[model samples]
Target: METVAQRQIHSLLAKYGESHLNHTNELIHFICIPAIVFSFLGMIWALHPLAAIAVTVVSLLYYFRLSVPFALGMLLMSGAMLWMLSVLSQDQVLKVSLAVFVVAWIGQFIGHKIEGKKPSFFDDLRFLLIGPLFVLSFLYRRFHIAY
Candidate 1:
């Protein structure tokens, strides 16, 4: 029998896949999504340490509700990003994060343009959260792990 996570993952991936059918777009997403995640985390970290912690906690909780393995992976990834942010000088954190955020978004738009479809996030804001999981699903497939 399929788990709740499996069913949800399938639904989310189907929605996410609609706009990501182009090979070029997929390649672009492979590069940009992680950058966007890290940059967003960095920007939150720059606001205040507590803000960053709050974001991480809320994000992990959401992922946990969807799937344990995905949540665990995100926790590890988020922890590492936060650690890297912690090491940066206060001023550099905001600046570097801003730069990456802008570039990554540009890449996202370019991918969408190539795909000839608007981003799924525009239809439902939750796609913002779905994006990372969509990317992770590919890795899960590669590793032969059921998401």
Candidate 2:
């Protein structure tokens, strides 16, 4: 059975159409997402585990409460990037990843244009974080996680 949290995320993804993201946008998102995560993790990892955990909790609270769409976008990008990184050389991959990040963000701007509405993240920052969890939840649903 899906947790209430998972169900809420799924409801949003269903409305938004996960596969609807542009192909190029998807590629760009993947390349940049993980880089950001690791970089942040690296910064916090040196601290005691409890302090790191605190930072994570605070960060997540910011994410879910603030910019959810951007967050979801990051999640999808992170998953795709993980797969790409496993195959590519480090230097070349970083360069490619940077390029993709720029392009994908541009694509997001374009999407908002088409929608005739500002990005949801602009309204509620949680949407940015929610975006990533949204993507992750898809995998759970696909594998038939009891949810």
The candidate maximizing TM-score is 1
TM-score of 2: 0.44
Per-residue lDDT tens digits for candidate 1, residues 1-147, read: 988877887898898899999999998998899899999998988889789989999999999988888898888888988889999999899999999999999999999999999999999898999898888888988999766
Q: Model 1 lDDT vs. the true structure?
A: 0.90
Q: CA shift at 58, candidate 2, in angstroms?
A: 11
lDDT by residue (1-147, candidate 2, tens digit) is: 655665665666554444335554444334433444543333343333344446556655554543454354444554454444545554454465455556656666665555455655565665555555544555556677533
Q: What local distance difference test score does each model get?
A: 0.90, 0.50
Best candidate, lDDT:
1
